[model samples]
Target: MKLFKNTFLSATLTGLLLAASWPTYGFPLLIFIAFIPLLMAEQNIRVSGTQKKLRVWANAYWAFLIWNLITTWWLINADLFGMLFANLVNTLLMSLLFLLYHSIAKRVNQILSLIFLITLWICFEKLHLIWDFSWPWLNLGNVFSDYPQWVQWYEFTGTFGGTLWIWIANAFGFYALVQNLSRKTAQFILIISIPLVLSLWMYTTYHSTGKTKEVIVLQPNVDPYKEKYAIPNLEVARGLLQQTDSLITPNTEYILAPETVLAQNLPFGNFEYSEVRSLLRDYIYLHPKAQFLWGIDSYDLVYDSKEVTPSSNFVRDNLWVNNYNAALFINRNPAYQKYLKSKLVVGIENLPYKPILEPLIGNLMIDLGGTISTKTTQKERSVFTGDDGTKVAPVICYESVYGEYVTGYVKNNAQFLAIITNDAWWSDTQGHKQHLSLAQLRAIETRRDIARSANTGISAFINQKGDIISRTQYNEKTALRGLVHLNDVKTFYVRFGDYIAYAALPVMIVLFLFGITRRKKSPSYYWPR
Candidate 1:
């Protein structure tokens, strides 16, 4: 009982440290040593060699649960059930990974065991990106988002690089402290310092030089709960236009509006006939040189002959249809291009394993005051080409969280990124703030200017270096006019795309096999009874 209490205390301390070092609040420096206490708890369990598995998992769960709750409790503002489900399930997944490492450590040398832990964690983060229940908000790489100058190197490695950096620093720092080796501790400091120094140097030296385009970003400040759906689409369109009319000039190359600015669900086939389209068409008629990109809730119905997809919703009379949370781009041409949001939020936008889980737990889907449906997505990462040959990546709300996923747009020749989101659903909580901060990482990774238009404020322009040039107040009805330089160059991260996580997969397999094959070893240190 005493041993359990000590381990539990250590785990809780670790969780506190982790939460205290997250972005949008707290110091990121603590992350270097955040995992030490939990690791010590796990080590104590392993050394004791009695009820090792159970104790390790339990301790890890406690730590992860506290961490999840502290950092993401704002989720409850959107959905109480979703908040609980995310915290419990994500913590369970993290604890299971740690438990796997604990099992591997028992049979292998300490160095190999550490390697397995690092690689396994990276693999887990990688899996989180691709999986149906992906919640990469706590991925260690994102810790540096609030301090973009410290992670200028993200342009080469992506967020996974930051994840690897954090893990390596924590592992080495923990080892040095455990063994009480001053020289090893110095080495850990050096390991942590080199990256910071390099990031600073790169941040100071880098500069963006290219054709500049003036952008006007709108924040409609429509309440998702009361005003968004209640107001007519034409009135919403007129409001957005009225806000941009004075701000936009002939030099205004792009006008960005928040996600679902047109709250009404328009049929994809007759999108041109919609009043929302007409308003935009009239605006484009006046400013023929300027391009407009805004979010819309759209749907399309397919007859019996049309092929059905996994996301298709079926109706009576052999009819199937799809609902899209999409970005519509209107240029001088009569035709407009649309990019459907691919990276759907777990319960709000998408139902994971829908063919199986929907029947069982479908009603549990949380309604965050937006279009709640199994949203359809497009396969291609579409880039919106402008009148002057410049291209912009139309990144929807949740899609901005994904690093490699956004790279697809840059790879397809997007010059800058335009992120449209409705962050009002979560209100004025850390949920929206964190979402805005994560976009900084994307800006640095892609090395492209970002024009973000949020529904309830935080509309801003981020430079190539991930610096917020100008921003509006939260929940404000305002518009931000700024000039974002258009660059044709692609960064190394955009070219390679999460290579660090991909490279870890093979190394993790090898380490896991080696750990399993090696003979069992006793700990070098003693555990307190």
Candidate 2:
């Protein structure tokens, strides 16, 4: 009874430490300590010989479930029903992952067990990134973004490497706590500490070779509820243009405004209509010298009927809804390019699993800006060339989260990254911070300077080494003008993606096989709940 009480308290304490170390407080070292108590709980389950392996897993999972629920409750604001489902599903997934670790630890030696846990944890992280209903937001590596210096090594291996580093630290710390081999455990800790200490050394000393450029980012602080939809289209356009004009100067080679700043009632590409054409012409004339990149909605006409509706077999459905979440690149020389956002946010931007849920949800099309519903057509990566022939990869808002997607441009020789976003909807929550934090990884991944322009919040310049050189205030109606760096040099992560995660898988398989071959010789022990 005393052991049970001690174990439960230890597990819960570990869970709390893990949650507290996330993006909220930015203390990633807390994660290295967080799992020590939980590992002790596992050791108690085995060394004390009180509970069956399965029962121990169930109890550990319950503690982790509680931790997940308490920490991620903010997801409810995104969509109440969606949040509930995500919490239940993700908790179950995490529990199964923990089960694999516990089962493997049953047969392996201490060194092998530690390696197994690290491999298992990273495999699960990779699974979440690729799964159709992926939620890569809460990755343990993301916790390190608060100490930007520690994650500078991301240029080599991406955030997954950071995940490995943290887990290895925790494993050593746990080994020190659970066993009584003072000298042996000290040796183990020293071995593990080598990598951790080296990462810190590398973090402080890393540098990048990249050229910088001067750019201006404007955030009007337009209220999502009031200013976005309250007034007439012409009134909103005038306000945005006036604000943009004030921020522009001779040195500002490029200017950026938030997503959907121009509130045209009609669809974006109804340009045959004089009103729409006039708006584009006026915008073009306003910023004559500087190249301006901003988000807008557009519907392009398709001449080839088959090309129009690629998904439909019948040409009768040829008038396909060519809706897009798009960005327009306008230069002083009357050159313009349009790039549609490829990766859409699951719930808010695109309906989650529309084909499966549409029958139950009753035409789940919630219109925001124009008459046409939010739809997807062709998805493309965009790079815009300025009047001075400076080329940039334009990352539209959510696309910044996808490291591989941004790196694809690096492989093609993109000079800089320009991300335009409307973060007003998320405000000061972890949502905004998480979004800003992840952008750092992309810069490190691609080895390219990032000019991030956000609405109602953090606009900043990120260097090739993933350092934020300059930034703007949250909720301020202001412009951040700075010299943004540019670089075409590619990092190892960009050249070879997910190498660490993939390499871990074979090691995990070996551990699994070793556990299977070394199954306990005695009859299975059982304990009642």
Candidate 3:
């Protein structure tokens, strides 16, 4: 009973420490020692001289569930059932991975145990990034988002590097605490200090490389629930035009608006007859230099059988309609361009395991702002070409959260990053703030300037160093114009993409085999100094 009490206290401490290290309002430094308590508790259970394996999983689940609720409970604002499902399932996945680590540690010696733990965890993070049930919201590396000055070295390592850095620090701190080594402070200090030092140096010394262009980001502040669907698309466009007319200069190169701003659906093949298109065309005719990009609700009509896809929704016997939450970029040069959002929000934008689940629950789907069916996505990252040959990546709301996925734009010669989003779904919570902050990490990783336009969250310009240069207040109906650097350079991370996670996969495989084949080891050998 006493042992269980101690472990429970320790698990709670881990949960609080991690929550305290979160972005926007929390002190990020706490993440270094946050996991030490959980590690100590697990270690104590290993040497408790009893069968307490179940205790490890129970304690881990408690700690992780607490972390999830504290950080992301605002998801309840959108859908009550969705919030609970996300928290429960994500927590289950986290605890299950930790249980695998505990299982390997029971059989292997300390060095091999720790090796397997770190490697397997990295592999899990990689899976969370690209897998079918993709959700990377709480990936450990995101802790440094609010403090971009401390992780400026992300250009080379990306967020996976930060994940590896956090794990190593915790492992060393736990080991030092166990050994009571006052003399081993040097190694532990170096582990925590080196990344910050390098980051600061880079943050101070690095200069942005590229031409500067003027950008105007519009935050029309349309309430998604109340006014967004109520008003006509032409009314919204004219309102946005009034805001843009006040900000545009002779040199304004790009004008960006929020996601899904066009409430009226347009035919996918041709947008000539679209009412909002004519309103925007008149505005663009006046400003010849300004290229406009905004989000819209549109669809494709597939009459031919060969044109049908897995995501195409059936309208009748032979006709199929494919709805898209898409971005449209227009200029006088090539006329217009389009890119569909691919990385979808779990239940809101996409149905998980759609093929398998759609059969069981036919025609039952959740609709937020877009359609109920699964959104169609393109295989490649599409880049919108600027008027004067500057390449701009038109990243949609949820798509901006992906690191490697954004790099696909850089690979295709995107000189700058432009994000359009509607953030009123969660309404005045950490959801918008965290979403804005996560864009900072992408800026650091790609070494490119960013201009983010949110409907009611925030519209801002971020520099190459992940620093917010200019921003609008949340929920404000406003517009911001700033000079953003357009760069054609690619960082190591942009070229190689999550190399730290890549290096750990093979090592994890070897250690997993070793742990599985070896017999259970003595308590003394189960942990290392």
Q: For this target, which candidate reaches the highest lDDT against the unseen true structure?
A: 1
Model 3: lDDT of residue 429: 95
- TM-score, candidate 3, is 0.97
lDDT of 3: 0.86
Off by over 4 Å in 1: 1-5, 362-364, 524-529
Stretches of candidate 2 exceeding 4 Å from the true structure: 1-5, 46-54, 66-71, 107-110, 184-208, 229-234, 263-268, 271-287, 300-320, 333-335, 351-380, 513-518, 521-529
Candidate 1 vs 2: which has more TM-score: 1
- What is the C-alpha lDDT profile of model 2 across 1-529, one tens digit per residue? 2433477787788778878887755566677777777776775566545455775677567667776776666666556766676677787787677777776666767668778888988888888776556776767777776666666667777888778877877887666544544566666556456655766787667666656667888787877655675555556556656676666666677777776655444455453353534565676575556676777655554546656443221214445455666777776554467777777665555655655665588445434445334446344466787877788887878778776667777776778888888887644777677788788878767777788888788888887667788888889888877776667667788888888899999999888888878865221231112
Full-model lDDT for every candidate: 0.88, 0.69, 0.86
How does model 2 score by TM-score? 0.85
Q: TM per model?
A: 0.96, 0.85, 0.97
lDDT of 3 by residue, 1-529 (tens): 2333498898998989999999978998899988888888888888776666788889889999989999999998888888998898988998888788888988986667777788888888899889767888898999999899999988988899989999999888877776666687899889999999989988899887888999999999988877787787888889988999889999998999999898666777767567777777777789888888899878888788788887777788789888798999988854679999989878776777777777898755556654677777889999998777889999999888889999999999998999999999998999899999999999999988999999986899999999999999988899999998988889999999988888999999998888899888777775443
Q: Which residue pairs come into collision in candidate 1?
A: none
Instruction: Please give, for residues 1-529, the per-residue lDDT of candidate 1 as tens digits.
Output: 2333488898998999999999889899999889988888888778775788999999999999999999999988888998999999999999999999988877876667788899899999988899999999999999988899999999999998888888888888767665656788678888889999999999999997678889999999998888887787889889889999979887887999999888877888888988777778877888887788999988999786467787887676778778899999998888998989999999888888888887887635667665567888889899998887789999999899999999999999998999999998777788899999999999999889999999996888999999998899998899989988888888899999988988899999998887778776667522222
Candidate 3 Cα misplacement greater than 4 A, ranges: 1-5, 49-51, 527-529
Error of 3 at 182 (Å): 3.3
- State residue 342's C-alpha deviation in candidate 3, in Å: 1.0
